[model samples]
Target: MWSGDELDLDAYLARIGYDIERDGELAPDLRTLTALHRAHASAIPFENLDVALGRPIPLDLKSLQAKLVERRRGGYCYEQNSLLAAALERIGFHVAGRGARNRSRGAALPPVTHALLVVTVEGEQWLADVGFGWQGPLEPVPLRDGVRVEQDGWTFGIGVEDDGIHVLRSLRATGWMDVYAFSPQTYQPGDFTVLNHYSSSHPQSRFLGQVVAQRPGMDVRRSLLRETLSLVRADGSVEERIVTADELAATLEAEFGIELDAEERAGLERVHAAGV
Candidate 1:
């Protein structure tokens, strides 16, 4: 059960472009679940701008709602998945908060650095994640072994190993690659606070010294780093280029829908301060 008076379901639904509803309750079915997942992926971008800005990442629900929903900004895994978990709980879905280590960042043993949700609806479990950086699944994938789900020409598969699940993504020419692995035994609610601190401040954290952004639009999916911009076309072809530092703000505003305010613009300079 959700721990608040009530979640602003209406606002959340609208934020993600979910219109259909069931009187008072959000249905816990595959259609509704997938719609919500897809809408969120298309709407809210996955970004780590706040970390670069030296902003304190509050794990509270109110802060998440304000930043992600009201302010129309995006965040990394902890913020994104937390907001989704709350909404799913209010909608009567059984939600479990889980953490993972990004293999892309170089998988280490006993990892705990990412956030995701395992939602049980109608006795079936689905992996729901809205904050995974580029190549993340756009739809909720079944938590079953050997099943492949496609999202925007990319494919994802889950394999059960050693009491946990390993998420794999198709690499076009290289075949499947390990994305991340997670198990309940390794994840604790307390882990997020510790991980959040490290991810937000530690110099070695990938988010600390870079500007990363991603979001999928009607015709294409856009992604960016400090200087690189990549667009995945509908035909599965990718166009990539290197943009100047001066062009980053405009690109964020125009492509990712994040218009950096004066404070945010000032924060851009701090990315260089990190790792020093």
Candidate 2:
């Protein structure tokens, strides 16, 4: 594991509302790793606001830290996982960046658009992802078959596919859904640059106007689409509403803790318009 020469470990820990000293169990154990994962998933959010507003999403470390950590913003898979991997490395954890495809059971697999972390702690490999918009496991789960992990009302498991294990999540409608599939090959920063650009700029991309944001919580999971705002309780019950255009910014701030700047606010307006 490498140190954070350019990355600010303290600021990142503070941003995620995590105190390393309080954990008292460092050295990359499963307990501390789970703490870090839960804290990050709850505090920070998964958002595509920049894509909605037609802004560039850069993959550089400084740009990611400045936007997510300093500016108090959230990002999609590429940006969010990149920041988490850096912070994990700073804390002396063995983190490797891995890419996964948003896949289905029998359909042809799409490109590798999702970025996640394979962290090795105490000689055990754990899958760590904080940016999946849909709710999933709150803590790091072993990358093995039949390992069930539950967070709030959501249930997740790693399925042993022929190629490798696939991350799966369960809900009321679909019993289990395959979110993505990944291999052990570590991906480089350059691989994500192309994916981020395509995800952000492609006219037909889902991120263009299909607003998706989430802030996972212990008791409730708050999420937002272009117009709908959902509050899912711990009992698997959901209460949701269609947020008006005028209320989008405030909903984002109050519910998801995302305070948008002028550009982002205007960008949200554009996103809502295109949908209508």
Candidate 3:
């Protein structure tokens, strides 16, 4: 029920690094999905800037959508995915949120969970994620299994787990790596807030102690993490480097479109010092 005036849509597109025409034109199916994927890669950077900087990250829809689209900023999964959901809904797509689970930093999974989104396009269901840094998906993948799929030059596959849930993984040089698991359950916005609170405010949550980000292009992916900045090209060559504190700040602004104030900078310095 949020309305994006002309200014709002323009601002939102700017935040995500998109330049879409605002007239009443609807994107064709492939173009719609592609735009969604690219919009996610460019506009909503995978980041926990608020938590690391000791600020209260709002979980409300309007606030999040405004920050990401209207103000031209980046956010973590909850923020990014949520804003993407809103935009998709605005553009005539049916969407739903779902619960998920992830380990904190290098830790093991919580006995409980996290949150994600399941989108319905045409007659196919796809996984739409705007969060999860570095390893995040570039295009919405079919929520089915037993077949290999490819996008943005990377191959992915889904299969049934021992527990009967759907599992996804990526094919890498070494081998396949597990990305996440999901079920066919339907979910809502309220479900997401619960998971977001646990992930954002819990002391053991790695978002408070570490930094992570990712961006996508036609055939490459760029990721900025706690101690590494890497670019994975279309042909699978990965160029990486360790960044200094100054470089980290620069990357946030230059790549993610986040504008951190002086106080936020001091807070980020403390997070770097803590080093998880």
Note the Cα lDDT for every prediction shown: 0.76, 0.79, 0.68
* Top-TM-score candidate index: 2
Where is the poorest 10-residue window by lDDT in model 2?
165-174
RMSD of each: 3.0, 2.4, 3.3
Best by lDDT: 2
lDDT of 3 by residue, 18-111 (tens): 6656422445364676576666665566777777766777867678866766665678777777777776766667778766655323345653
How many residue pairs clash in all the candidates, one count each?
Answer: 0, 0, 5
Candidate 2 or 1, higher lDDT: 2
Clashing pairs for predicted structure model 3, backbone only: 11-69, 12-69, 15-72, 16-43, 100-114
Candidates 2 and 3, the one with greater lDDT? 2
Winner on TM-score (2 vs 3):
2
Q: Which ten residues in a row have the lowest lDDT in candidate 3?
A: 1-10
Ranking by lDDT: 2, 1, 3
Clashes of 2: 0
- Could you give the candidate ranking by TM-score, starting with the highest? 2, 1, 3
The runs of at least 3 residues in candidate 2 whose Cα sits more than 4 Å from the true structure, single-residue gaps closed, are 1-3, 103-109, 171-174
**After TM-score superposition, what is the CA distance of residue 59 in candidate 3 from its true location, in Å?**
2.0
